[model samples]
Target: MNIHIFQHAPLENDTGAINHWINKGNHKKFYTRLYADDPFPSIDSFDFLIILGGPMGTYEEDKYVWLIKEKEFIRQAVNAGKKILGICLGSQLLADVLGAKVYKNNKKEIGWFPVTLTPDGRDHALFAGIENSINVLHWHSDTFTLPEKSIRLLESEACVNQAFLYETHVLGLQFHFEATPDSVISMLESDSESLSISSDSVQNSEEMLNNLHYSGKSNEILFTLLDRFLAL
Candidate 1:
């Protein structure tokens, strides 16, 4: 399989946790680092496209010039029937490109949280092995409305639209199922100001580090989702 990843920042790129899953199959993986001004690939260049998360908001096109082009590329990829995965900000971008409204949630989710799977998510083929409610790492404050023709998947206490399925080939997850200990640290280091130690929805750096085991379980669920997604 030919896989392409769109990374919004250096530290927030694909981590070893996801590498272990995607590397299981015979695949050639490529990257387009929008933070570094790397050129976007042609839609036909890859069979699958994975969009990684970043600190930037989806609507901040004036501050991040590449975001506009990135959304367009994602839209084209979706239309082309490419199997795609979008994480956090990538999910917001996907929702925006698909005509969904992206906005700030009432609370920012920045720690370990449980996501309850919707009825469709529980019965969905892509989430075959995933449980109805699972604790996953959350670092995003923005949430999106479900796109047209999309099935709502997961919901958390702070975010209603935690995950969504756009057709059979497109998946968007608000939480970071692919987060590793290192990636979590990188995120904290890069955007520490966003963390609120006293907030009900946020966890401190120490708390985040101590609960690294949650990431392992999340990654297992991610692997299952990826396997089922690729099989289709």
Candidate 2:
């Protein structure tokens, strides 16, 4: 399979998601960072497009001029029938481009949170095998509306717009399923302002890293989703 990943920041790189492809060992991977010196690709060469998260807001387009271009590319990809997955900022971008409102939430959720699947998500292909309510890492202040044609998937205490599926292949997940232990550490180390969490709700990097007791089922569900897409 040919896969192109649009990475918004260096710290929020694909972790287990890349590993999912690497374990297959028969796919090609390409990465581009719009904020950095890199440029976007033609978008036709890849069979799948994975848009990773960033700390920047969707409307920060004025500051990050490439936002418009990236959105156009993503829209074209979705219209072209390619499988796509958007994470955090990427999820907001998908909703915005699809004529859905993207804005700030009431409270910024920045740690492990429980996500409950709605009726539609319980029957969706990507969410296949996922349980009723699963805990996933959260680190975003922005939220998005479900596209008119999208299927509502997950919801949480702080963010009602946790995830949505526009079609059989296009996905927008607010929470991080691709985050690994190292990626979590990198994020914690890089974004100090986000760590202003009170002692009661937050755990430091060392604690998070040592806490392998966290559920792996959500990660497994994401893997199944990726495997299904690649098979198509």
Candidate 3:
């Protein structure tokens, strides 16, 4: 399987969480920030499409012209029966492509938080037999509306629309399941100006990377999800 992973920014890489066990499949990365003129390929050429998170908002298609085309590309991919996964901002963009509203949430959730799976999620293969609630790493300020054809999977205390499934082939996650320690530190350091964390809760990049609750168990669940994805 050849998966096409769309990277919106330099900081948000795949972190190799999904492909930890599935080394047989191949992947290709396309950075929209650096190459705004790059055209999207037909959905048939790729087995799966994974969109990584970025610091941009879903509605800022004008400010970031590449977003408009990226959303359309995702829409076409999902409509073509291809497997699709979106993380954080990528999830918001997936909702936008599915005719849902995306906007700022009441609070900026930027640490580890517990998310409970819904009945539909409990029944699905990706989340089958998984615990009712699991702590996941989150770093986003925006949230999306539950799309018309989507099933709400998980809900956190701060964000209700943490995960959703539009179709059997499409999945959107509000948390960072693909985050590695290096990628986490890269996000905190490169985007320091965007964050406003105090010295107590989240002091610096190193502290955020060293946090056990966020990074420790995340890879386990992430690989579990990826294993299900590869099987599908």
Candidate 4:
């Protein structure tokens, strides 16, 4: 498969389960580094598109010019029926492009948190290997409403809409199932200001680091989802 990745930040690239899948076969992988002004590829060039998380909000197009172009790229990909996976800010982008409202949640969710699959999600093949509820990594202040005609998949204590599925081809996740230890550290370092804020919803850098084992189980779920997605 010809897969293309849209990486919004220097530190927030896909790793762990995603890298494992990418290295599994002869499949080609490509990337567009939006932070460094890397050129975007045509929608037809890739069979699968994976958009990574970033610190920026979806509405900050004025500050990040590429967001406008990226949205258009996502729109074109959806129109073309590309298989798409979005994480965190990437998920918010997908929601907004699909005409859903994206905004700040009542509280930010950082570190490890539990996410429960909705009935639709539990029954869906995309989550076949995942448990009904599991702790996954979280690091977002914003949440999105379910897109029109989309199935609400996951929910958390701090965020109601942790995930959504738009048709069979598109999946959006607010939490990071693809994050590695290095990537988590990168986030803590890059967004240290946000981490400094004290709240019940937030976890300290040490706490986030201590729970690396959660990703082991999360990566298993990720691989299950990816296997199903690739088969589609």
Clashing pairs in 2: none
User: What does each candidate score in C-alpha RMSD?
Assistant: 1.4, 2.2, 2.7, 1.3
**RMSD value for candidate 1:** 1.4
The Cα local distance difference test for each model comes to 0.87, 0.78, 0.76, 0.88
User: Would you list the rank order by lDDT, best first?
Assistant: 4, 1, 2, 3
> How good is model 1 by TM-score?
0.95
Question: Per-residue lDDT tens digits of candidate 2, residues 1-232?
Answer: 7788888877767555456655676778888887785887786788888888988888998888888888888889888988888889889998998899998876677777678988877886666766788877788888988898888888887788889878677888898877666667677778867667664335555555665335365566677767775564
Tell me the tens digit of each residue's lDDT in model 4 across 1-232: 8989999987677555788878886679999999999999987799999998888999998999999999999999998989999999989999999999999998989999899999988888778766799899999999988999899989998998999988888889999988767777777878877778889889998899999888888887887788887776
| Between candidates 1 and 4, the lDDT winner | 4
TM-score of each: 0.95, 0.90, 0.87, 0.95
After superposing all C-alphas onto the true structure, candidate 4 shows an RMSD in angstroms of 1.3
Write model 1 residue lDDT over 57-76, tens digit each, in one string.
99899999989889888989
Q: Which pairs clash inside model 3?
A: none
What TM-score does candidate 3 reach?
0.87
